[model samples]
Target chain A: MTDFKVKGKVWLITDNNGELINDIDTDQIFHNQFLHITEISEMGEHTFGNLEGWENFPEKCNPGDIVFAGSNFGAGSSRQQAVDCFEALGIKAIVAESYGAIYKRNAINSGFPILIFQQINNFVKDDAIKNLDEIEIDFLAGELKNISSGKIFKINPFSKVQKDIMEKGSLLTI
Target chain B: MPGKTVIEKIFTNHSKEDISPGKIVWIDLDVVTARDFGGPNVVKNFHKNYEGQSVFDQSKVFFTFDLTVPPKTIQYANNQMICRKFAKEKGVKVFDIDKGIGTHTLIENGLVPSGSIVVGTDSHMNILGAVNSFGQGMGDVDIAFGFRYGRTWFEVPETVKVKIKGNSSYDYSAKDLVIKALSILRTDKILGKAVEFYGDPIEKLDLPERITFLSMITEMGGIVGFIPFNNNTENEIKKMSGLDNIVPEIKADGDASYSEIIDLDISDIESMVSAPPYPHNGMKVSDLEKVNVDFGFVGSCTNGRIEDILKVWTILKGKKIKEGVQLSIVPATIEVYKQAFEKGILKDLLDAGAIIANPGCGGCAQGHIGMTGKGEVMVSTGNRNFPGKQGDGFNYLTSPEVVAFSVLNGFISDREF
Candidate 1:
C-alpha cells in the first residue's frame, strides 16, 4: 500500500485577485487541442494551457506538489486528461470544496487523491493559505496540517472503496 | 413503508447489500459501451490487465463512433482503425460512422433497458436517465474494468426532488423549460446529487423533450436526472424496442427523503438565451443586445432529435437564411435522417439555404466542421457554451426556435412566444 500520510507544497488555483477560483472546468485544465495525446508522460506540459495567468503551471509546479481549488474543480467533460495531467506532474493530491460527480468517479477509479475541504471559504476569508505553502495530509485520519501557517484542520476521509483503490493504484489492479 | 428515491430502488434491484447515500456498492451493469474518442484507450487498458481474455459478455459491449466519424486527420483515422480491429477480433459490435451519436444510438435503437445501469466513455451518457435508467460516464481504465467484469462500484447519491408546477401560458419548448430551471437553480444547487423530476408538466413531455431537459443535468453537476416513467415513456420504449414491458414500473416513494425539495413554477417563464464562458449564464432573449452571428449549428445529443428538426423545418420552410450567414443542420442518427428525408424535411431546409450535414456529431467539436474564427459569433442548439468548444468564436446556447429566428435575421434573436 502507498503512504497514507502525504507532505507536499500547496499551489492554490486562484484568480489574479487572490480569491479561490471556482468552476475550473476540464477544458481550462487541459484544452481540447491536446486530447489527441494518449501518452501520460507527454500530458504534463499542457496542464492549464487554456487558462489565463496559469498557462505555465506545468513549468512552475514541482514534483509531489499539492493543489487547492474551489467548488466543482472539474466541472465540464469527463476527459481523464484533466486528472491524468496532474498525475503526470507528480501531484500528491487535490483538495477542493466540491467536485463534479463524474469527475470524482474518474479520479477515484484511477487512484488519484482528491480530498474534500468543506470549510475552504473560511480559509479564503482569512487569507490563511498561500501558494507554495508546505502542508501535510493524512488520508485515513482526515487531518490536514499547514506547516507554513501552523494550522491544522479536519478533512473528509476516504471511503471504503477509495482506500482500497488507492492501495492498488487503480481499479484494474484491484 | 418508508420512502426511497429512484436511484435507491434501481440499486436495490441490482446490488446485494443494503443501499444508502455515501455507501459504496458494486452493481450489475446491463449495458457497457465506448465511443471513438475514448474507445481506443479503453481497449488498450483492457488488454494490459486482462491479456488474451474475452470480455465478460460480448452482447453487453459495443463501440459507437460519432466524434470525428469520417476521420478528419490521420491520427484520428489510426485511432478508429484500432477500435475497428479490436471489435472485429473480439467479435464485438461496432456502430461505425454510419450511426449518429452513440448515446442517441443506444436510446433510439433500444440498446439501453429502462431502470437499469449503463456505463460509457461519453460524459453525456446520463441522458439515459431520461428513461428511468441509471447511466454514468467513467474513465478509460474504469470502463475497461467494466468490459472485463460487467460490474462497477458506485456510491449511492443523495437525491433532490424537483416538483415542476404550472404550465407556461407562453408556447414554450423543452429548451425554455430547462433554461428556466438553470436560471433558478444555477450550477451548484444540486451538486453531487440526483434530481427526481415530479409534476404534471414533466409527465406531459414527449420522449425527445424529456431527453432534451435531462441532458443538461451534466451542466448542473447532478450525477443523473430521473423522471418517473409515465405512459408516454412506456409507449416510446415499446415503439423503439418493439417489445412489451421494456420500461419497468418503478418510481420513488411519495415519502422519500431528499436533500432538498424545490417547487419550480413555469407559468410565466420567458424565452431565454445563454451567452459565452458558461452555458448557465442566461438572460432574457429580449434583453440581449443583437450580435451578428456568422455561424449557426442545430444538432447534438441534446436537441438533435426528430421533434427538434421538425421545429426548424416549420420555421424555415419557404424562407432562406440571410445572405452571408452560414447555417448547418445535422440529424442525431441515421434513423432520424431517413425519416427527415422521407418526409421532405431535408428538402425544405436545403431550399432555405441551409447546409445539411450527415447524421453525426459534426458541429460539437473542433475536429468537426462548425468551429468558428476569432471574434466571430455562433448561435447553436448544442448543450454547452464553454470556450474552445467550437473553436475561438464566442458561443451562445439557446433553443432551436431562437436559433432558427437568429439565423434568418443574421443576428441574435428569438421567436415570439
Candidate 2:
C-alpha cells in the first residue's frame, strides 16, 4: 500500500455557528435544477448552489482544495452529480465523519478521494480553520496535520479496495 | 453454525460460502436496473468502458424511461434517446415512455423473484425487498459494470430486525407505518443496514401494501428492507409475473443473529407525516392540520400501485377537490395505468378534478410535471422531502388517502377508517 499525500487550503462546510451540517443530501450538494447540465466543466458553478453558506463556491473555490464535513456527508439520492461536482471543482479529497453508502461507492469508482475520521467535524467546526495555514493529508499514514496550528488528527485507514481504486484511477480501469 | 439474516443468507447462497456483516463479497447479480437519469450515465460508461465488450446477459438488464418520461426537455429527451439506443443495441428490454417506474415495471412484469439479489442505479430499488429479495441501489458506473460482468461488489450490511405487532385501520396506512419507522430510526441510524420485517404485522400486509411500506426504507437510511418469504408473498409474485410456481423460498434461520431488534406496533401508528426539509421529521396528521396544502400528489414508485390509487379513487368517487387545490395522480407504470384506467379508477380520479399524469417519476425528484412554486406546500406520497426537492416549496410525505382528504379539505387533514 502506498500513502497518498496532499496539501491544500481547507474549506469548512458548516453553518453560521460553525457547527458542521449533517444530512447534506446530494440535492443540497448540487441542486437537481442543474441536472440538465451534462458537461462536468459547467457543473462547478452550481456546486452547493442550494446550500446556504456555500452558494458562491464556484468562483470562491480553488482546485485541489480539501473539504471538511460532518456525518452523512453525501446522504440522500444516488445522483452522481454530488460527487462529480466536487471533482469538477477540483476538490482534492473530502474528509467527513461518515458518508452515505452510495456516495462512498460513487466516489471510489470515480477515483475521487473521500476519507473518514471520527471527530473530524469537531476540528473543522467553530473557526478551527482560522489558524491553519495549510492542511496536509496522508491517506496511508492516517494522519491529518495542520501546518500553522501544528495539530495532527488521526483519520481512519481506507479499506484495501478503497485505496486501490483511488490509486488505479477508477474501478473500471482496475 | 448459527443462523443467518436474510442478507447474510443471500450473500452465502450466491458465493456458496459463509457470509456475515462487514464482509466484502463480489456477488453475482440476479437483476440489474437503471432508469432515465441514471440510465444515460450508465450508457455513457458502457460506451466508454465496454466498447467492444458484449453485455454479460442482455436479458438480465432492465431499463426504464422514467424521471424524464415523455421528454420534459430537449436535453432530457436526448438522454432518454441514449438509453433507448443502448437498450436496443444491447438487446436489453427498455420500458420506454410511461412505463411507470423501473421497479414497478420490473415487478409488474414478473421479472424479479424471491431470494433474488437485485441492484439498480436508483436508490429506491430498496423497495424490492418487499418480496424477500435483497434489492439495493448502485451508481451508474457500477451498474454499467454489472451489465458487463453480471457481478458487483457489496459489503454485506448488518441486519436490523424489526418486529411489528397490531393491526392498522383503513385511514392509517402502511405509509404511516413507514413514516413512523422513519421517525424512530432516523435517517442515519440504519445506514448500510438491511432491515428485516417480522411478526404478524408484516405477514398481514399484501404485496402492494408491502411495496408501499418498504419503498421508504431508504428514507430511513436503510440499504434494503425485507418482509421475508411466505406463501402470500409467493402468490403475489406469481400473480404479478403470471408464473405458476416460483423456484423456492429463501428464509432466514430461526436463530438468525440481529444487530438490533425494534418492536413496532401497527395499531400505535396513526396517519403520520414527514414535514418539510426531511423525511425523519415525522408527526401525526392531526398535529399538522393547520398547514394548508396547495397541491396533493398521489403517485410514485412508493405509493403509485393499483391498491393505492384505488384507495384514493374510493374516497374521491363522488367528490371534487377543494377549490384552488391541485391534485395530481401519477401511476407507477403503463400496466398500473392500464389497470386503473380499465377499472374506471382513473375516471373517478379525473371526475374528482385530479390531474392524471403520464406514468413516470414526475415531481418525485422535482422535475417534469407537478412541481410547486415558491412558498407552496404539497402533501405528496413520494419519498424524501429535501429542500428544493420538488421546486421551491414545502413537502409533507403521507399516504394516498391522506393526500386525497387533504385535496378535498385544501389542508393537511387526517382520514378516518
Candidate 3:
C-alpha cells in the first residue's frame, strides 16, 4: 500500500476558549431529532446543528477540511449519522486526542479517515489556532506538520489491521 | 500468563485465535441487531452494496422497531416499511410495532442465551452483558457486514474489575448503585474498556437488577458491563430466556489481570442522583432536596423491569402524584407490560395519575411521546441526563423509588418513605 497523507485546512471543533472540548457526543455532532431524514446526501446541511460554536459548521466548512478535537469525540450513541454527516460534507479526516470506540470503527468502516495524535492539544490550545492555516499528516512518515508554524509533531503508526483497513478503503473491502 | 476475563475468553473462543487487549481479531457473530433508526440504513446498504447477497443466517439477524414504533411520521413510517420489506424478502426475524425495546424483546424471546457473542447497531446493546454474553455496540455499517457475512472485527478491550462487598437496607435501587459507581470511576476512566462487576453484592442481585446495572455503563462511555456467569445467573437466564441447561459458566481466573479494580461497599452508599447535564454528575439525593421537579419518568430499558416498577409501587401505592407533577410510566417490553398489568402494577400507577406510554424506547430515546418542555425539571429513571436526552428540560437521574417519591412530592426527595 502507498503512504497516505491527509493535508487540508484545519477546522477546530472546540469551545470558546479554543481548547478542544471533551466528550462532544454524537447528539451534538448530528442531533437525533433530525434522524428521520434518511438520506446522507442531505445530512451536511444540519451538521453540528445542536452543538454550540459549530452550529453553522456546514456553511463555514469546505470540502476536504480536517477536524481537530479533544478526548472522547463522538462519545455517546452509535448513530452512524455522526460519521455520515462528515462524509456528506466531504471532510477529509478527523484528528483527535481520543475517540469513542464505536465511532473509530464506524469511520474506518465507512472509508473515512480518523487519526489519533496525543499531543494535538498542545498545538491547538487557547488562541494558538488563530495563526494556523493548514496542516499536513503523513502516516507513513509518522509526522504531523503545521503549515504556518512549520512545527512538526510525531504520531504513532497504525497497527497491521488498521493499515490493512485503510489500504482497502473499508473493512468490508478488506 | 494471567487468565483471561470473560470478554477475552469469548473473543479467543470465537476467533479460534489468541487475542489480547488492543489486538484486533475477526470472529463470526452469533447474533446481529438493528433498531428502527439504523435498520433501514442497513437494509439499503445490504441491497445496494452486496448485490443482493443473502445474509449468513436469516434467523440470527433481527431488526426491532423500538425508536419510532407505530411510525410517528411519514418518514419514520417509510423507514419502517423499508426494513419490513427487507425482512419479508430475506426471511429474517423482524419485530415491529409494540414488540417492546429491542434488547428486552431479544431477552424475552430467549434469543440471547449465555455464552453468545453478539453485536447490535445501537449502543445500548451492551445490556446483553447481563446474560454473560460478549455483547458490544457497533456502527450500523459493521452490523451490515455482520448481516452479510456473519463476521466482524473487534479490538479486545482492557478490563476494569469492580467488586461489590456490602448490602443495603435503605431505599437504594440498582440505578443508585451504578450512578455512584459512575461518579467514582468517571466517564474518561472507563472509556472503551470492559467493566466486570463481581462479588457478594453482585451475586445477590436478581436478573432485573443485573440488567439494570449493565444498562447504565453506556452512560460512562464504557464498551460493556459484565456480571460473571454463575449458577444463579445461569438459572435466571434459563428462567427469563426460557433456555434450560445453559452452557457452563465463563469466568475470569483468580489471577486475571485488570487495568483497575474498584471495591465498593453498598452499605456506604445513599440514594444517589445525577445533576443536570451529565450522567456522571452525581451527588447524594439528600443534598438536593430543595430542587423542584415538574415531570417524573419511571421507565426505560435501564429501569423499566417488573422489579424496578415494584420498587416504585412499594412507595407510591395508594398515593397520588403531586398535582403539578406529570408522571409517565413505560415498561420495557410487551411481556414486562403484560406482567405489570396482570400484577395490577399498571392499575396502581394509572390510578395514581401516571400516564403509561407504549412499551418501547419512548421518552428515553428522546423526542418521543410525552417529552419534557424547555426549562422543565424532570426526575427520570432513565440512564442518561445529557442535554436533550429527554427533550428540552433539565433531567436528574435517580432510582425509581426517588422518581416515585419526587412525583408524589413534586420535588427531588430526601426521605426514604
Give every collision pair in model 1.
none
lDDT of 3 by residue, B95-211 (tens): 887888888788888888777888887788888888888777777788888999998888789999988777667656678888888887777888889988888666667788888
Task: Classify candidate 3 by CAPRI docking class.
Answer: medium
Candidates' chain A TM-scores? 0.97, 0.92, 0.90
Model 3, residue B303: C-alpha shift (Å): 0.7
Point out the worst 10-residue segment of candidate 2 chain B by lDDT: B164-173
lDDT of each model, Cα atoms only? 0.85, 0.82, 0.82
Model 2 residue B34 CA deviation in Å: 2.2
- Indicate the fraction of true inter-chain contacts that candidate 2 also forms: 0.47
Cα deviation at B210, candidate 2, in Å, is 1.2
lDDT of 2 by residue, B157-272 (tens): 89988888776654567888888878878876787788888887666678888898888887777888888665577888888767677767777789988898988765767788
Q: Model 1, range A1-174, lDDT digits (tens) per residue?
A: 488889999999888778778888788888877776778899999999987789999999999999999988888787888889999999989999999887898899899999999878679668777788899999999999999989999999987888999999899999
> How does candidate 3 fare on TM-score?
0.96
Give the top-scoring candidate (DockQ).
1
The DockQ-based order of candidates, best leading, equals 1, 3, 2
* Candidate number with the higher TM-score (1 or 3): 1
In model 1 chain B, where is the ten-residue run with the lowest total lDDT?
B240-249
Per-residue alpha-carbon lDDT of model 1 for B14-92, expressed as tens digits? 9997888878889999889888777888888888899999888999999989888688888788888988998888888
